[model samples]
Target: SPHIVLSTLTSYCPRSPHIMSAISKAKKSADDARDAAAQVREVLDKIRSALSHHAHDTSLLVRLEGELVAPANDVIRMKTYTETAAKFAGHLKELSEKVGERIQLHEDTPASQRTLNVAFVARTKRNASQIKAVLCQAEDTLDYLHQQALSSYAEVVLEKGARVIEERKEERKEEQNRQGKNQS
Candidate 1:
């Protein structure tokens, strides 16, 4: 009777708590990531909207293209902006790669007899594509973000470098003056 009772208790012990905990953690992570992705997606959407509005309101896009082709003072500014934009663009791209790795991790989960279903595979494929599309747009938006960030950085660096060089020149002049006074 003791052995029978022990066996029954063990058999009846709930597996739900452990399973639920895992599911809860996964759900929390999914929600957090989705929220973050939504924020980034909104940014990308706004950028696209702004570009469309600009093109609609003015022929800026067309005229800008013409200006871009001609050799002018703007070329240096453009090149500087381009370099900065590339750096931000790289950061955005890195974020996209993280999303992709997460998606692949989800897709790679092994099927089990206790929870196996064809729908799981279907949904996984659908979600992967949707997330991939969002990531791609994020990469595209990086172009604008990079340009803005880089242009600002370039300006700051130029200002700082010029000031530093000027300060060094002044220091050299001061040293020469001290040397001349000593000689006199």
Candidate 2:
């Protein structure tokens, strides 16, 4: 798991729409990326067919390389991101299990058979301590997963930016060459 078996956030989570939306977005992005990869594969197959017809064509080969490499890299990054998300979900499930345990132990206990005054204080303290332990574990798990996801995204963005910069540099150089040839 990306994080540990983990801790509980609250006794009752009550299904936040924001959390659901985030999960949906993550799944959608991975699916979209997968679809993009499929399209890229089709493009490569066409490139291959074109190259087969013209064995000595540098343009087709260049197009194949340029088209395949970036998307291939992106697919790898998306795989990592999705795997990390799955780990995060596993830890969250663990947390939910812990919360359920807490509910069984405390909230469901018969109130008529309950402790009073100092005893109540002691019980609360014990419950608090147990909950705190669970929460601390959960906090660490979430923090670590957050760090990993952010790092993955940052790397993807940086790699993409690097590729774009290189492509733009090549374009500017070509434009300059074209202008020089016209001037001459």
Pick the TM-score winner: 2
**For candidate 2, which ten residues in a row score worst on lDDT?**
2-11
The model with the greatest lDDT is 2
Error of 1 at 10 (Å): 68
lDDT of 2: 0.46
In candidate 1, stretches whose alpha carbon ends up further than 4 angstroms from where it belongs are 1-137
- The C-alpha lDDT values of all candidates are 0.43, 0.46
lDDT of 2 by residue, 55-169 (tens): 3333454455456555444444455556643543454445345435534544444555445445544554454444345434534443454455545434444444455456567
For every candidate in turn, the CA RMSD to the true structure comes to: 28.3, 26.4
lDDT by residue for model 1 (54-93), tens: 4222133224323322222222233434553345345454
Residue 144: error of model 2 in Å? 2.2
